[model samples]
Each structure stands twice: as C-alpha cells, then as structure tokens.
Target: MIKYYYPDGSHCYRALHTAHAVFRNEAGALIARAEKPDGSALYEFEITGFELVVAGERCT
Candidate 1:
C-alpha cells in the first residue's frame, strides 16, 4: 500500500518536492508519488506537504 510508505523530508536539491518515500519492502530505493488525499490515483497531482496520508493507505 502507498500509505505504509515512509516519507523522507528531502526531495533532493535538484528536484523540489515536499515528500519522498520508499516502500518498507525495498531497501535504498527512493520513490516519488502524486496521489490524491482520498487514496485515489491522480493522473496529475500536486504536492503541498499538507496531505494527511496515513502509514498504510493505498492509492489507486
């Protein structure tokens, strides 16, 4: 699930994003996501760092 992902407070200086995460199952793999707050998949979404996502919510 997407929510179970843990967010790191950095998006790298080259790229600007509020959240960056990696699934618990993966190691040393960084990820970027733009899903809606309601757990719906977004064709195009924006990140403002104010999302109330949990640690186990799925996105689709």
Candidate 2:
C-alpha cells in the first residue's frame, strides 16, 4: 500500500498501489499518479504537504 503523511506526522492520504510518479504542477500542487491495486483504472491524487511511503518503507 501507499501512504502519505504530513510534516506533523498526520495522515494525509492512502492508496492501494505504489505511485507511478509524483510531481508538482504549474500551480505548485503536489500530485501523485498511480493505478489501483485491482488494476481497474489510473488515478491522480493531490497530496500537498505529504511525504510518501510505499509498503512499510519511506520513499525519497
């Protein structure tokens, strides 16, 4: 699973699969692109102020 956390260690968002990529938009919003664990469809999440964690490990 994928998890996002705030700088203060609060939970931000969670998803089933790892993110394919993450980047900031022209508007400076943090975004994550990923597919659902079931492989149903792709999705994008706006996850500003959140750090990424894949499985049980933190992602740089």
Candidate 3:
C-alpha cells in the first residue's frame, strides 16, 4: 500500500498496491495507474498538495 499526504502532514489518499504503480502526469499531478506493471494508465488524481510515501519512506 501507498500513502499520500499533504504538505502539512495531513492524510490525503491511500492506494492499494495490488499490481499497481504510482507516477506523475503531464501536468505534474500524482496518478495511480492500476492497469499493469508497465504503467499503462487507468486512474488519474490531482495531487497538487500531496506527497508520496511508501514503506515509511518519503518518495516525493
């Protein structure tokens, strides 16, 4: 699982990592792509104020 948070340390989103990956969009928004491991897109999220956290480590 991946946890997304705001800059102020508030909870934003939690995404299941079952064959899924997260990345940025063209506009620099955080996106959760669950289609395939190759990063084929399915869902897009506007994460303007969110930061990526994985395994208790901050990724972005």
| Per-residue lDDT of 34 in model 2 | 74
Query: What's the C-alpha lDDT at position 32 in model 2?
Result: 77
lDDT of 1 by residue, 1-60 (tens): 223223444321212132344222244343344444554553332222332344333342
lDDT of candidate 3 over 10-57, digit per residue (tens): 654555653255677787766654443455655544443333455455
- Evaluated at residue 57, the lDDT of candidate 2 is 59
Give the lDDT of residue 37 in candidate 2. 68
Model 3 alpha-carbon drift over 4 Å, by segment:
6-9, 12-16, 34-42, 48-54
What TM-score, computed on C-alpha atoms, does each candidate reach?
0.19, 0.55, 0.42
**Candidate 1 Cα deviation (angstroms), residue 52:** 18
Q: By the TM-score metric, which is better: model 1 or model 2? A: 2
Best candidate per TM-score, number?
Answer: 2
Model 2, span 1-60: residue lDDT tens: 466644455665555545687778898877778777678887886664444454455653
lDDT (CA) per prediction: 0.33, 0.63, 0.52
Q: Candidate 2 or 3, higher TM-score?
A: 2
Cα error, candidate 2, residue 56 (Å): 8.6
Stretches > 4 Å off in candidate 2: 6-17, 50-60
Tell me each candidate's RMSD, in Å, in order. Answer: 11.2, 4.3, 5.9
Clashes of 3: 0
Winner on lDDT between 1 and 3 is 3
